[model samples]
Target chain A: MDRLGTVAVVGVGLIGGSIGLALRARGLAAEVVGVGRDLASLQQARERGVIDRATTDLSRGVAEADVVVVCTPVGRIAEDVRHAAELAPRSALITDAGSTKRGIVEAVERSSPRAAEMYVAAHPLAGSERSGSAFARADLYQDRVCVLTPTARTASDRLRRAREFWAGLGCRIVEMGPAEHDEVVAYTSHLPHALAASLAAAVPADWHPLAAGAFRDGTRVAGADTELWTAIFRDNRGPLMNAVAKLQDRLSSLKYALMNDDEESIRRWWSDARARRLLFEAQQPPEA
Target chain B: MDRLGTVAVVGVGLIGGSIGLALRARGLAAEVVGVGRDLASLQQARERGVIDRATTDLSRGVAEADVVVVCTPVGRIAEDVRHAAELAPRSALITDAGSTKRGIVEAVERSSPRAAEMYVAAHPLAGSERSGSAFARADLYQDRVCVLTPTARTASDRLRRAREFWAGLGCRIVEMGPAEHDEVVAYTSHLPHALAASLAAAVPADWHPLAAGAFRDGTRVAGADTELWTAIFRDNRGPLMNAVAKLQDRLSSLKYALMNDDEESIRRWWSDARARRLLFEAQQPPEA
Candidate 1:
């Protein structure tokens, strides 16, 4: 892979800082710049060796970049990408790590035509419940699935560069349309988070002590940052709502089977579930 | 604590074999006899030192026991308890490890009055996706919550003996009425399992490769035994349905908030969920 001349990471949070760290650790970028609203976080990123330079101005920070990754909250991704597009050279490839893709892609196309042509919406399907630059790790994206959502406006060169950039960071690049990306992730990611939250809220306080590994594992994603998840839910409402409806239908069938004491139906439902889960486990990459 | 003199464990599967292993490993039982419909499992249990003796005849196996734990599948628990009560010594304390308590308790009370007096409905809130005697471990229940659901028909001495037996195996005994146990576990256990299955079924097959830790953890319980879970859901239909209703309401509110783009409401809902999950994690016993 060709080494990036200058790489800029906006937000300086867990994802942004980790990207900077990975870029620097792999020598993928000659200079890694951290950009965020929080001066303290930017300074910490620099001090932690996640970046070679720190800047509070997004436009100024990304002006000299060969590649710019907008890692802001889902709500702020569009504006930051537009800023990066306006400031950076036209040849500089722009991408994002937003959880949702359709909204961000649409906003970019509407607000910045030049950036729209250069921008490729991407979401790395990896994270921990822990947030902030302080918890950023260099190997966070290793062997993880990073979905690239490219619009019709996205240039082939820019798209190819974005894919190679993520691939260089040890990610398995999966190309998808923005709408398809949003819908697929709504079921695989957003729906599960919502279910976890609902499960966490529905259980009685008295039952907390008796909660074993099942409850703990089931509700683990409920511990995510509220503001970030709220933005994700709001930004990807259409697909997420559809996913929820599908999940509710599945749940309703199980409930109906239980209520009617339909042993065969219940058995089949569970057997299908068991089979699907086993298939998923078998297909997963060996644990790193 | 006085040693249990000849503990007979019925079914000799994961839970039963684990109980036998824990009893013998901790020197809590002088002799642990294994009873099962499968001769091979009983023989394996004996060879693995999970039990001192193996038998296919339930009556002959438990006739001289001081304690008889009926660890059959949830659907057959009532019948197994009645058989243990008829076959075991009159002085033996009879108990069961059924996931749901109300149905089992009511069935026992109605079928055999003698068993109702001696039987304590217990559920150890511990298990793995793996099943059978092959995966049995001595410390399966260590520091795990074991709910004892004793009805009015349950004698105080028998209940105490059941509590002591679980406590001796390093379990934390929690006493609750059968109905309360059903309701609490329906939300904490059964509802989560149903959601996992629903999530597993709703996702597209192509999304499996993109699944991260969140998806893996969320659907972990979907891999559990289909027959075993079907029995549990059928046995606890009322409470499990009520739990599903509660979870659906919670999910609906979240969906409504997202659909309306109600950022404030979404933030508040997620904040509450995060807080509740953190509180639950804080209260949990240190992971074994």
Candidate 2:
């Protein structure tokens, strides 16, 4: 793996803090700079040894950096990337850890064509409902899947650099187009969050205490931060709506089977579900 | 708690085997007998120290037992309890670990009004998607919720014994009517399983590898045994069906919000879900 001179991590939240810690722990960067809107949070990250330097000024943080990684929420990712373009070194590889890529990629490319050559949008498929620097961990991305949504506008060198950066943190690299990444994650991530929220709301508060493994596991993601997820939902609304409609259509079929007391059909559905879930369980990491 | 001279556990699979292990570990019973249709499985239970004895003959297993627990699938719980009533000692406490209460309780009382004096319907809110005796653990029920559904015909002494028996196994006891148990679990347990299956079935197979925490957690219960869960869904059809319908209705609200890009309403739903899930997490055991 290639070592870096300076790495600026914008937003200094869970994803940013983890990146800083991983880079610092591996001795991969000469300097790891934490940049955020809140000086207090960036100071806390510095105090906790997540970063060697803390700065509220994005320009001061990335002005001399070899790589700039933006780990802000979906809504702020493109703006931060664009801001980095104005000050970051011309040779710097600019990347982001946004959950949604198409909107950000398009927005950044539309603003400045030169920025696309330096930017390669990526999403690491490992995060918890809990957020912030407090919950960040150095090994958060180890052995997890990280998707790189590269466009034709993306420079080959910068794409490779983004892949190496995430790989250095122990992520298995995968490449998909921006639209495809959005579609796949609409079903894989966003749709499940929508379903969890709906499932959590459907159960009455009085009956929640008796809930055990099934209820707890099923509704786990409903504990996620509302503001962050709501923006992702709106940003990727088209594909998410399609996924939600498909789930409803499938539930309708099961509903009809239950209404008619069609044991054979219902059993067939359960059998398929059990087989599918087993296959998924096998593909996941042991702890997952 | 009163010590048991002998205990017969029918259908010694995951639930029955766990009960046998817990009883043996706590020295609650003199002998824990395993009974099932498969002599091979019963023998395996014995070999693994999950039970003191193994028998394919249900009558022989329960003949001299002080307590007879029917841990069979929902479809056969009533039949097993009635069989025990005919052969077990007059002092035996006849109980079941069926997920649904009203169906089993009504069937037993209808068959022999005298059996109600000994029978108690209970649902131990434990067990895993993985079945069979191999996965059984002595601590499976520790600090878990176990609801005892006592009927009007249920003898006061038998209900007390049932409560003591589960509590002895480290359960947190809750009392509800047979009908109430079905309704509560229909929302808490059965609805979640149904949603998990529907969600699992909706996602394309190729996209499964990309599924991270939300998809895995949301669809965890879909891995449950087909025959066992199908029987539960059928046995608790009225309430379960109502629960499935309510989930579909709730998903519709989220779908509309997505279609219209209604950020405010979507955030509201997510906010409510987060609060409800926090309350549930607070109530559940730490390991859950």
Candidate 3:
């Protein structure tokens, strides 16, 4: 892989800024150009050295980039891709860092028909409670899994190029159909967010003041960017809804057991879940 | 506070062993006596110097100590308190580290008629995912809230002595009634555990192999020690049940909003939760 080339990252927030920082640290890009509507954030990103140069003009940022990575909120991913596509020249390999795949794929396919062949849908399974370039670490993606959802119509060379790029950043690649990806994340990611938020909301509005550290830790996900989450839940409504229903069923079972004083059933339920979680914990690092 | 008295740690598990270690670290106790059935764990505690002595003979251990802290599983607290009452010297102060309070109070009132006057109920709002003496850390309770739930009948001098002992180990004290303590914990702790476990159980049994990091992070509490938790929930059943009901009701409301595609309701729920969590996260750390 070339050590130096122009790379443009759209939406210079946490994900975008992290990508630029990672690229710069690895010497993978000569000029890391950032594009975002917030001029103040762009300036902050520059002072923080997350990017070599940045601009509010999306077209100017993408026109000459060798690689264009869209790192916008889930809601704006497709729109960002469409705008970038109009400015990106031929041979520019584009990709995304969106959590969901199907919507981004559909949006890019419809709005950026010319750049469809160059775009690869990718999701890096990593983050922190803090956001923006200031918190970005070069090794954020180290040993983390990055799922790439590529359809049959996706260009083989573009897919190969995208895989090579993420691999260089030390991310293990998992390939799956977009629908399958959505379903898995619905259970693993989206449902957890909704569950945490609902648990937080369930605190009688009057009781929120009395909540302690455990409640705060358990509901940490409830504090995530609401606009981003709303877009995700809306875009992946089908799988997310299914995941929610399944979770509600399990909760209902536990509630019934507790209500009826079914000690044996409740213990068995907890025991089974504990065993599974122990196995899962053995495989991963302490979550950040 | 003279640091020359024998300290009896009743359970000799994570919290107890950690307390033993912390006691020794501060030179606050002349001897650390560990009481538990497991000889091997007692040996480990001795080897690690968490305790100066260890034994399975609860009667002898309790009789030898000037200050006896009940660190057993919540279900076992009453039994331990009763047994200790028979053997513990007249002047020894008895305290507990149970998550719930009302049940412990009831148990103590029922089982240890003689020691009720000396008993000081306390809940140290501190713990970790790891367990056993091997994982014990002397500083675990540092800068954490330690609530003392004393009944009107509790001896003020003994309560003051216990509070000073805890302060020596570096803890900020909060006082609450047993009933209020139980209710607060149900909302802050027990309810979250139930939700985390239920979420884990909701994953299709066949899908366990495919369950990934996000699911694992979401369900981390599901991996907690079941026996200890079972004891907690069983002993604290009334308030735990109340909290679960409130949580279930909250979950149902969110489910209804999702099912009806009520975007406005969902937004309000998410925003409210996000607001509260941000507030909690931004608050200063608890005084030790």
Candidate 4:
């Protein structure tokens, strides 16, 4: 396996720290630099062996890198990607781990031509409700899907490098049109988050004692980082609202069934849902 | 430490089988009789040590019992409880483990005078996505909350006996009005189920491969029994509808935030949900 000379991980949070750790652990990168706003957090990441070097200066941090992975919040990913592209060597590849891709891809296209050519929009579908460097693990990307949304203007060499980088970290890569990626993820990820938060908010304080495993499992994602998810929802608002509308339609049908005491309709609805879930579970790769 | 001479368990499914296993394992009952429509399932329950005896004859099953715990599907619970009440000794206590309470309590109240006096509606907040006797465990009720919804017409002696029975199975008992129990559980249990099912239903078939931990956790309850949940929705329609409305309101606010790109509103909604979930987690008893 060919190893990169240097890999700069901007933001150094859970996703970035995990990428740094995985690359270092796999001997895929000779030097892993942690870049962030907080010097203390970057230093902590270095101390934890998540990175080999730490720097609060974005330009200085990415200057010597062969690759730069922008791991900032969804709202900041485009700017971070553009900055990484401007600072890194001409041959260096730049990519991001933003949950939403269309905005980032379009914003990167509007950046300087050289920066646009270096950037690939990527979203690795791997994370927990917990966040930050402390919770990062080397195996976070193992057996998970990482979607790459490359525009027609994206350089082929850079896109290949982005795919190789994620593959090196054990992610199974899938390429999708940015708009399609946003729409699919809206149903699979964003809508679920919204529903979880809504369920959590609907629960009366006094009803907490009576909640069981079902309630706990259903609302687990409601505990995810607020700022990160808010940015995601805002960035992909159009597709997310469409997803919400579809879910509302499904819920309304069920509500109507219950209201009418339509046992057959309710049974069919739940049965179809169960069948779909079982199919989805069947499609999952075996646990590592 | 006092044990009932005999305990009759109606419907040898997960809850019923679990109750039988716990009663026998803890020596809370001298004899545990399994009763259901399927003779083979009853025999299987006996063979698996979930019961000491098996019977398809409801009358014969409850004839010698000191207590009868109705564990049939939500739709059948009322009738099963009434049948158990008619068959059991006049001194026998009757209770149920239906997820919804108001309908069961009302139906029992409309039953014969003896049945009404003997019945106490109970809903145990413990279960997994998996169902049936094969998954039943003796420790299912350990440290779990079992809500006893007793009406004004419920006899004091029977209520006391019902409390003792669940307590013996390691359940912490809480008494609530039947209507209150229905309303509370609608928010905590039924609404979550409906949302999980709807989310599962909304995901496109192609999106399943991209689904990760968040989707799995959000839709876990969509795998629940269809007929069982359908009956529950029908039984608790009013309160469940109210719960659905509250969830819709919360979701609509988030939708408005997303549509307007109001990051602050989105952040605050998710942050409040996170804070509430943290508080709920803090209040939970240590996992057994």
Candidate 5:
């Protein structure tokens, strides 16, 4: 395996820290430099051995790097990627692990077309409700799907390099159009988050103990960082709203069935869901 | 440690099987007889040591039993309790692990006043989505709350005995009125089930692989039994509907915020939810 020399990771939180950990552990990177605005957090990542070196200076961190991975919050990813593009070597291939991709890709193109070409918009579908360097694991991306959203202007060589980067971390690569990727993830990822938060918030504060396994499972993601998700919900507002509508329709049907005592309709809806659950569960790659 | 002599468990699935296992493991029961219409399932329960004896005839199973625990589905709990009450010894305390309580209590009282007096409706808030004796565990109820929905008609002695029965299985007993129990669980249990099912059913089948942790956690309860949940939804229809409306309101506010790109509102909503999540998570009892 050819080691990527001096790989720079921006915004060294869970995703960034995990990327550094995986790259360093797999001998995929000769030197992993962590770049972030927060010096204290960068120090923590360095101490934890998630990164070989840490710096608050973005330019200094990525100056001689062959690759840059922007693993910042969704709200900050485009700005961070643009910043990294300006500081890193012109030949450096920059990629991001943002949940939503369309906005970032569009913003990068609007700011600098050359930066957009060098940037590979990739969304590695491996995230946890838990965040930060403390929770980062070396195998976080193992056997997980990494989606590349490439448009007409995306550089083919950069896309290939991005695929290679994620592959090195044991991710299965899939290409999707930027808009389509957003729409698909709206249903699979964004919608579930909204529903979880809504369901958790709906439970009366005084009656929390009455909650059991179902409530816990449904609301586990509600414990996720609020600022990050607030930005995600706002950035993907259009598709997320559409997803919320679809969810509302489904819930309305179930409520209608219950109100009318339509047992047949209720059973039919659940049967469809059960079939899909079994199919999806089958498709899930076993954790490494 | 005085053993409860000849305990009869009707409709021995996960709940009944777990109760039997707990009692047997603790040496709390002299004999745990499983009574169900499915003789094959009962035999399986007996073979797995979840029960000491198996019988298809409910009357024969409960004839000489000192205590009868009716662990049937929500739709069948009332009928099973009445039948068990008719056959079990005069001193036998009949309790059920049905999710909904108001409907069952009312039905049992309507059918037979004495049966209602003997039947103390209890909802053991310790069920897993996985059903059947195969998933039964002796520690299923350890440190979990077992709610007793005792109405004015409920006999005090029988209620005390019901509390003792659940306590023997390592459950914390909480008393709530039958209607209140149904209402509370509608928010805590039934609503989450409905939301999970609805969220899962809304997802496109082709996009299943795109689903990850958030989607999986949000829809886990959709993996539950369709017919069983359908019955539960119907039984707690009114309160579940109310809970659904509250959920809609929560979601609608988020939608309104997202539509307007109101980051402040999104953060506000999520902060409130995060606070509640932290509080409830802190209150959760450690698993034994």
Candidate 6:
């Protein structure tokens, strides 16, 4: 596989900025250029050493890049792909770092007519409650799982290079179809975000001051950028909605058992959940 | 208020062991004696400097203690309270660190029929994924909240002493009725655990190996000891069951919006949850 050379990262937010830092810090990329809407933020990212050259002009950043990673919000990925495709160097591999896959894949297909065959759908499964480039850390991806969704049209050589690119950044690469990826993440990630958000809403303002560590930690992810998650849930509506329905059904069963004072039912309900969670928790952290 | 001196911690597992260590490190207690079901665990606690002494005999530990704090599973709190009550010094003030309030309050009432005036129902909202004496940290309670349930029958002097004791250990004390406390925690704590468990169960086994950081962090509290959480849920059945019903209804509404591709409804469903969660998350590291 050809070594990932000059790279352009569109949108120097937490995920984008961190990927740039990690690529450079790991010697995976010789040059890392950043593109963003805010010129001042790009300059800040450069001064902080997240990128070698930073520009507000998407054309300037992607003109000579060998690899381009689109890191815009779900709603805007199509526009970004279109912009990057026009400026991208010939044979440059394109990919994204979005949470949902199907919408973004469709966006790429529609926008990047030229780079469509080179594009791959990827989601790097790492983030912190803190946002912005200032909070970006090169080590954030270490031992984390990063998923790649490649369609039948995607070039084999490009797929290999994308896998190598993430592997170099210390991520264990997991490949799946875009549809399967959405279904899995809906239950594992999106549903939890929704649950946390709802739990926070249910608490009265008077009692909020007294909310303990459990509530705070449980709802921490609920504070994630609203616009971004709004688009994510909107894009992955089918699978996420399915997961939500399943969860509602289970919760309803538990409520009935509790309301009816069915001690045996309650005991079975808790024991089952406990068994699976404990097993998951016991798994070894991916080989460091 | 009488100075907290020679605090006795019964059943030195996570909560009890940590309390002993925290009291000793902060000089909140002159001496701490650890009482446990297992002699080896008690011995380990003492040797680890969590307590000044260790004993398997409940009577021996309670004889000279100015304050006795029971930290065991809620199912056994009554039996343990009765055992310690028989040997507790008449002037000693007794409290517990169980998750449930009403059941434990009733247990304290029944166990110490004569000395019930000296007993206070308390629950300190501080813990970790790690358990046992080995995981105990001195500053575990720093900036944490502790709830004190003082019924009309509860003595004012006993309440004052319990508050002072917790305050010295770096807990901000809040007053609430047993019923109210359980109701609030049902949404804030219990229901969240149930949600976590449900989400964990919903994930496919194949995806379990590929579970990412968010899934792990989101479900950390869900992997709680089954026996402990079971006892707590059962003890606070009325409130927990009520909260579960509300959560299920809310979740069902969310499912409906998602299933029907109702963008406006989904947005409204998540907007309030997101706003409230953001507000809660904005309150970082509570005032020390």
Candidate 5: residue A114 Cα off by (Å): 1.9
- Tens-digit per-residue lDDT, B1-288, candidate 1: 798789999989899989999999899988999999889878988999988999999988998999999899999999999989998888889888889898889999999778888789999988888899989999999999899998778899998899999999888999999998888888889998998988888887788876778788999999999889989999889998899988888888988998789999999999998899999988876663
Which pairs of residues collide in candidate 3?
none
Top of the candidates by lDDT = 2
**Tens-digit lDDT string for candidate 6 (B31-86):** 89898879988898888998999888888889988999989888887667666667
**Candidate 2 C-alpha error for residue A212, in Å:** 0.2
Label model 3 with its docking quality class: acceptable
* Model 3 clashes, total count: 0
Candidate 6 shows a clash count of 0
Native-structure RMSD, model 1: 1.5
TM-scores for chain B, in order? 0.98, 0.97, 0.93, 0.97, 0.97, 0.94
- Give me the overall lDDT of model 4: 0.89
Better of 1 and 3 by lDDT: 1
* Residue A288, model 6: Cα distance from true site in angstroms: 8.8
Q: Single out the weakest 10-residue window by summed lDDT for candidate 4 chain B.
A: B279-288
Our model 3 lands, by Cα RMSD against the true structure, at 2.7
Instruction: Estimate TM-scores for all models.
Output: 0.97, 0.98, 0.92, 0.98, 0.98, 0.91
* Candidate 5 local lDDT, B117-150, one digit each (tens): 7888898888877899999999999989999988
The candidate with the higher TM-score, 1 or 6, is 1
Provide the global lDDT of candidate 5 against the true structure: 0.88
Q: B1-288, model 3: which lDDT tens digit per residue?
A: 777589899988889988999999999988999999998989989999899999899888988688899998887887787778778897888898888889788778766557788788998877765678898889988877788999977888889888988887788788889998888777777888887887777765544434444465568778778877777777677777777767667666666777777777777767887887676666646541
- Residue A229 of model 4 has an lDDT of 90
Model 4, stretches more than 4 Å misplaced? none
Alpha-carbon runs more than 4 Å astray in model 6 = A1-5, A110-113, A260-264, A284-288, B1-6, B27-31, B110-113, B260-268, B286-288
Candidate 5: segments with Cα more than 4 A from true spot: none
| All DockQ scores | 0.82, 0.84, 0.46, 0.83, 0.80, 0.57
